[model samples]
Structures are given as C-alpha cells and as structure tokens.
Target: MEEAARAGRTLLGKRLLVTGGSRGIGRGIVLAAARAGADVVTCYRTPGEAVASLEQELARTPGKHQVVRADAADPAEVNRLVAECEASLDGLDAVVNNAGSFLPRPYAELEPEEWDATLRGNLTAAHLVTRRTLPLLGAGSSIVNIGSTVAFLGMAGGVHYTAVKSALVGMTRSLARELGPQGIRVNTVSPGRIATEALDEQPAEAAERERRMFSSFTALGRLGTVDDIARTVLFLVSDHAAYITGQNIHVDGCV
Candidate 1:
C-alpha cells in the first residue's frame, strides 16, 4: 500500500506549507506530501538534530522541500513564512497546520502564561497561518489542520492543550463552509496517542498506562505511528479526497 501510494503522483505540482514540520508527525506529513509529488515547505522554530536528519533524508527524495525558520506563535513570522513558501513554490496548494506544542501541566499548576502560550501555538497559529496563506490558495486547494483525539475525549492534566486542540474542529468546519464555494477544502485530522517527541516527556508509569488505555480503545490493539497520520493527511489533501471537506477524520487506530 505504501509503495502504491508513492507510485500515485496524484499530488504532483501541489505546493504545501506545513508548520512545526521539522520532526515527529509534522515531519511524517512533510515526507508524505513530498512522496506524493508535492512541493513542501516546513516551518520550524529551532534547528535540532531532527532538522538535520530530515534535511538529509529530503535530499535523497525526488520531491522538493524547503525548511523555513519561524515561530508559530508569532504572527509576523507566520506571515513571513507564507511569503517565503509562496516565493519558493510559486503558489500555495495546501496549508497543513501541524506545528503545535504540548505541555501537560495540571489545571491548578497551569500558569496564565502557559494558557496563553498553548492557545497561541495551537489555535491562534493555525488561524493566522491559514489567514495569511489563503490569499495564495485558490480553487481546488485544501487546508489540513492537525488536531488531537483528546479534543473530544478529555485528558486529565492537559487542560490547555485539549482546549486549544478542540478548537480546530470548529475552525475547520467553519472554514469549510466559507471556502467550499471557492473550491477550497478544509478538514482536520485528529490523531490518538502517538509515540513522538511530545510523549518522550511522560513519566514511565504514566506512559505505560497511556499505552494500555489507547491500545484498549483501539480495536487494532496497537498504538498509532507518525506514518499512519501522515498517510491519512496525504489522502485528505489529494484528489482521492476531492469530495471530502469540513470533516474530522480520526487516525487513532480505531479509537
């Protein structure tokens, strides 16, 4: 199935901008978009080891990829990132709002600054990125917002993250209704617990419990991988999903 997807150049000529795309699920989406023949621009706040590895990996791929330095919480930087992507790719075919931060502080322990930071990174960034880049997107283009299953299913100690993540659903539905007439599709991909950098901070016992819980919820009896979310995202933005929009597709392995 993976090879078949790679063989299908359905996304050829598409130009995409993905935020927080230096690593984890965002990196997965970047590679998937490129594998589907789309020109991809990924935004990152810092250049880490993952960034170096991704650049090396992309260098070997046939697809074109550009890494832009930008802070998702900064409106100015977001606008500049869009302009850079447009200049590099000629136009915007899709915007994948995948850049987000996860800090699971308890409600009482959560500071005002934490709340603001969470909302700014997760919700506001998506809105700002889309708003600035929409001008470059036209008919037949799409926007894929990366949401979390925690949006619908509450997770304790992750109040701020869950609150902002839930916002993506409403945002995508509204954007879909408004952009549909213009032939642009907006959708959300809500993923379950995936083993990514975000999860690396989890306490061993807590992480084990989470694993057990997510596995039980999923009939597949396994945790989801970054590639799973990436493949789903690729389909959503491709011609295969031309008729789909304003929907939230959960890529949580049956959870």
Candidate 2:
C-alpha cells in the first residue's frame, strides 16, 4: 500500500502547507504528502534532532519541499509561513493545520495560562493559517484540520484540551459552508491515540504498557499507525474525496 501510494501520485501537482511538521503525527503527514507527489512547505517550532532528521528524510522524497522554522501559534509567524508557501509553490491546493502541542493535565491542576496557550497553539493557529492562506486556495482545494477523537468521547483529565479539539468540528462545519460556495472544501481528520514520538521516548517497559493499554481500548485490538491517519488525509485532500466536506473523519481503530 505504501509503495502504491508513492507510485500513485495522489497529490500530483498539488501545493500544500502543513504546520507543526517536525515530529509525531505531523512529521508522518509531511513525509506522506511529499511521497504522494505534493509540493510541500511545512513548519517547525524549534531546531533540534527531529527537524534535522525531517530535512534529511525529505531530501530523499520525490517532490519539491521546504522545512521552515516557525511557530504556527504566532500570527506573525503564520503570516510568514503563508508567504513562504506562496513564494515556494505559487498557491496552495491544500492546507493541513497539523501544528499544535498537547500537554495533558488534570482539570484541577490545569492553569489558566495553560488553557490559553493550548487554545493558541491548537485552535487559533488553525484559524490564523486558514484565514491568511484563503487567497492561495481556490476551487477544488481542500483544508483539513487535524483534530482529536477525545473531543467526541471526552477525556477525564483533559477538559481544556478536549474543549479546543472539539472546536475543530464546529470550525470545519462552518468553514465548509463558507468556502463551499467558492468550491473549496473543509474537514477535520481526528486521530485516536495513534502511537507517536512520545511512545518512543518512554522507557521500554512503560512504552509496552502504554501500547497494550491503548490497544485494549480499540475494537480492532491494535493501535493505529501514523500511516492510518496519513492515508485518510491523503484521500480527503485528493480527488477521491472530492465530494466529501464538513465532516469529522476519525482515524482511530474504533476506539
């Protein structure tokens, strides 16, 4: 399936901007987008080993791509990101608001500042990028907001995170209505506890425990891979999902 996606060129000739592409699921999507034949411009918040590794991996991909150091949560940086996108690829065929941070905390312990920061990074960033980049999108273009399944099912210790994540659903629906008349589509691709870099950072025993715990939550009895979510986004932005819009497509394994 992976090889087929590479050969298929699902996003052939498409120009895309994916935010928060330095690590985790965002990193996976960036790699998948380039491999699927899109001219990609992705951003990272800080410089580190992950950023360096992403650049190296993209170097071997088959499309024109750029990795910029920018914070999507900042309006000024988002403006700069859009400018770079326009300059690099002319205009965008798709925008994936994948840049955000997640720091789970108990509702009692969550500070007001943390809530505000979370909103800025996760919710406001998507709005800023989408609004600023609207001109670069046109008929047949798509905008996908990376969301979370916890928004629907709810989380015990993450009310703040859940609130912001849930906002994507309403945002996507409204934007789809607003942009549909212009022939643009908007949707949310919510992931369900997909294993990512955080897992790798855990001690082996703890990581195994987490993997097993998360897997037990799924109907499929397995955790989802980054590819599972990436492939879904690929379809959503491609001609295959041309008729679909304003919906939340969960990439979880029925968790």
Candidate 3:
C-alpha cells in the first residue's frame, strides 16, 4: 500500500517550507514530500547525525531540496530561513509549522519560565514562521500546523504543552478565515502517541507504562508512526484536500 502511494506525485512542482524537518515527525514529512515530487526547503536547529542523514537522503530525492540550520523561535533566524527558502525554491506553495518543544511536569511544579518557553517554542514559533511565509504563499497554497491529540485528551502532566497545542487549533481557524479569500487553506494535524526518538528516551518503567496505557485505550491496539502523520500532511498540502481547511484532523488511531 505504501509503495503504491509513493508512486503518485501529488505535489509535483510545488515548493514547500517545513520547520524542524531534520528529525522526528518533521523528518518523515520532509522525505515524504520529496518523494511526492515537491521541492522542499527545511530547517533544523542544530548540527547532528540526523541533519547529516537528512542531507544525504534529500540529495537522493528527485526534487530540488535544501536543509538549513535556524532557530524557529527566533524571529531573526526565521527571517533568514524564509529568505533562504525563497532563494532556493524561488517561491513557496506550502508551509508546515512542525517545530515544537514539549516539557511534561505537574501544573504545580511548572514555573512561569517553563510555561513561557513552552508557548514560545510551540505556539509562537508557528506564528512567526507562518507570518513571514504568508507573502510567499499565494492562491492555492496551504499551511499545516503540527498539533497534538493532547490538545483534546488533556494529559495530566502536560498542561503547558496541551495549552499551546489547543491554541494552535484556534489559530488555524482564524487563519483559514483570514486567508480563505486568497485561496489559501490552513489546518491542523493533531497526532497521537507515535514511536519516535523522544519516546525511546523515556525511562524504562515510564515508557512501558505509557505503552501499555495507550495501547489499551487506542482502538487500533498500536501506536501511530511518523509515516502516519506524514501522509496526512502530504494530503493536506496537496490539491486532494483543497476543500478542507480550518479543521483539526486527528491522526491518532481513534483513541
């Protein structure tokens, strides 16, 4: 099924800008877009093996691609990143606001600083990138904000994280209304728990506990994958989802 899907180039000739595209879910979307025939410009925060690997993979993909190092939360850096994208890809057809940070802690233990950082990393970063990229995105363009299922389910220790994610849904609605006349679509893709490097970093007991808990609750009896979210993003940015906007589509397996 996956092989058959890859054979269709849904985003042929389109140019895309994906933030935090060197690792995790962002990395998956980057490769998927490339395979679907979109010229991609993606940004990473730091230099590492993941970035190196992504560069190698993008080189092999048929479409024009670029990987840059920039801090999504910093306005100055975001400006540079967008400038590079415009220069490399010529113009943008889509933007995926996928750069985010998650810090789980009890609401009582969450300091003001931590709350502010969480908002800036997730919500503010998306706003900054989207604001700057709007001019480049003309009619028929789309924007997909990477939200989380926690925004709806409300995790116990992720108040700050969930708050920002919930805000993203509201943002998407507002943006869709504002951009609708211009023929641009805006939407959110809220993902459930997926096996990523971050999940593997959890302590043995905590990881196992979550695995069992989510498995029992999720109807599919399995966690989602990066590819799961990536495929949805591809569709959202493609003409297939042209009529879909201002909505939060949960990629979670019916949790």
Candidate 4:
C-alpha cells in the first residue's frame, strides 16, 4: 500500500491519453505513465493478448487506466476515443500520439492508394486525434508526437513514411505556437531503430544486415529500446519540462 501510494503521486495526478498503447512503443509509454502515477486512458485498434496483458498490468497500478479499441485514423473512432478519455479519466493533462503506420515500398512502385493510406495512418491520424482531444486539455497540458529518425535522415524505401514524419515535426512546431498562449506545450520525439516486435519480425538475414550497418553508424554502438523512447516521453510531459516546448527531441543514439 505504501509503494502503491508513492507511485500514485509520481505524475502528481496527471491524466494522460495515449494512442496505440497496446503494443510496441505505445505499450512502453502506457506502462511507464502508469508507473509514474498518471491515470492513463489509451486506445488500441484490435483485441489481443497484448491488450489483455496490458489491462492486467495496469490493474496493479494506483491510477485509473483503460485500454479501448479505436482506429486512430477514423474521425468517428477518434471522437469516440476522446469521449471515452473524458468519461474514464475525468480530464486529460497530456496526450501522446504514438499510433502510426510504416509501409515501405520503392518510390517507383508505390501506388496512390498506398500513399494515401500511409498519410492517413501516420499524419492525418495525429491531426484528428489532437484536434478532437484539444478541448479536454487545458493550460500546462503537453503533447508528444512520435516521429522517426528517418524523417531527418530519410529512408530509401520509406519515402511516404519519412515524408509524413517530417510533417509531424512541422505540425508540432505550429501547434506549439498556436497553443503556447494557453500554456500548452507540444513537441516531437524522433527515434532511430528501436528493437520492437516489428524489428523482430524482419527476416533473420535482413535483421543481421541492419545490425551490422547500424552498429557502425550509432555512437552508442547499438540499437535503442522501447524504454529509451518512453523515458524521454515521460520527462516531456512532466513538470520538469515546464519551460520547454515546440522542440524536436531525437531519441536516436547519435547516428
């Protein structure tokens, strides 16, 4: 009970809404926020063991936590998600836009539909979610949009992905300027290659090739982990970052 009580005060009662919180980096953020004493209402697109497992883990935490199913790209679903966050968490003090799609294809072979899907999934989804959730957030609220290092360095087969991520950086700056008057802060967290389930799914040969390539490029001499991004996110939303806003923070290990 003492430890639970301590955990509940970590974020000083901040309520957070995290998109795509059931898996990968999203899962890491949800869990970390809960541990930091924030009541979290997170959304997932599907039901699976991952969602079930996160539900169980959050149950042990002190703050209120809910995992719901909502397609971040759909406006109707995003509205429902915002409503659920308001209903379940009372109000929102922070938002983490971590839901995005990464579809890699040669620029020459990319279809119009694929390009639209990638934009809707990565860029438009953030706009929709943020616009809808803005009403619930007030002064001192923070928003962190998850971007990729590819946005800066560019990836050969991921032109669409990189383009949308680059847009997020611009969006972050614009939103920060517009919302700063209200004491709201917005920023982007761009991560390099991180070891997530997606990374594990790569063919062994491809994975090894990437490992060898990234090792020489990164100053830290290895890839990042989900926690590497999560910790940065946690700080960005906390009071410690009160004076900071409209910044693009790269979590990539100096590549």
Worst window of 10 by summed lDDT in candidate 4: 3-12
Local accuracy of candidate 1 as per-residue lDDT tens digits, 1-255: 978865786688889898998888999899888877898899899978988888887787777788888997798998789889878888888999998987889899999999999999899999999999988999989999999999988989998998998888999999999999999999999998787765667898988888788788888998898989998998888878999999999988777
Per-model lDDT: 0.89, 0.92, 0.94, 0.92
TM-score preference between candidates 1 and 2, better one: 2
Candidate 1 lDDT trough over 10 residues, lowest sum = 192-201
Clashing pairs in 2: none
**Highest TM-score against the true fold, candidate:** 2
- Give the count of colliding residue pairs in each prediction: 0, 0, 0, 0
CA displacement after TM-score superposition, residue 156 of candidate 2 (Å): 1.6
Candidate 4 lDDT: 0.92
Q: How close is candidate 1 to the true structure, as a TM-score?
A: 0.92
Candidate 1: where are CA atoms >4 Å away? 1-6, 197-213
lDDT of 4 by residue, 1-255 (tens): 988778555586899999999999999999999988899999988899889999999999877999889999999999999999989877799999999887789999999999999999999999999999988999999999999989999899999999999999999999999999999999999999888887778999998888778867899999899999999999999998999999999988999
Q: Which residue segments of model 4 deviate by more than 4 Å?
A: 1-9, 202-209
Ranking by TM-score: 2, 4, 3, 1
Better of 3 and 4 by lDDT: 3
Q: Per-residue lDDT for 185 in model 3?
A: 99
- Taking all chains together, the TM-score of candidate 4 against the true structure is 0.94
